[model samples]
Target: MSIPENARKYWRANLKYLAVLLLIWFAVSFGCGILFKDFLNRYSLGGFKLGFWFAQQGSIYVFVMLIFVYVWLMNRLDKKYGCNEPNSRKK
Candidate 1:
């Protein structure tokens, strides 16, 4: 079954955002965690090595934050693009 036009537009916009976010996530998680790990380990946060923390925890936190941010941004986009459902007034 084909998606409704509004849904297609919303999904296309969301997909673009997801692609960019995933790229950044991969760069930080893989590139910084493994490739530049030695350099990153030179810094420490609390008792944890910075690179280790990022590899183990920071990326997960960033991913969660991205989800919330995406929801907020998409809500705004829906309003701006008139894709948000209209509210009905009650008597």
Candidate 2:
């Protein structure tokens, strides 16, 4: 069965958001932690070398933030596409 055009467009937008966020996460985690560690090591954050922090704790923090971002983005997307759940409490 063919999917509705609106559904297709919604999924496309959702995937786009996923792709961009994932790419950012990858760049910050893998790229900064490993590939660019030397350059990042020159800087410090919270007294820890930047690259080392990324490899150890920074990535985890970024991932958590990204989770929140994804939730926010999805909530907005759902509202835009009329897929959000109805409010549980009404005045």
| Residue pairs in candidate 2 whose N, alpha carbon or C atoms collide under 3 angstroms | none
Tens digits of per-residue lDDT for model 1, 1-22: 8867776787788888889888
lDDT of 1 at 4: 71
Expressed as tens digits, the lDDT of each residue in 5-38 for candidate 2 is: 8789889999999999999999999999999999
Residue 45, candidate 2: C-alpha displacement in angstroms: 1.8
TM per candidate comes to 0.75, 0.89
Candidate 2 lowest-lDDT run of ten:
82-91
Clashes of each: 0, 0
Model 2 Cα shift for residue 36 (angstroms): 1.0
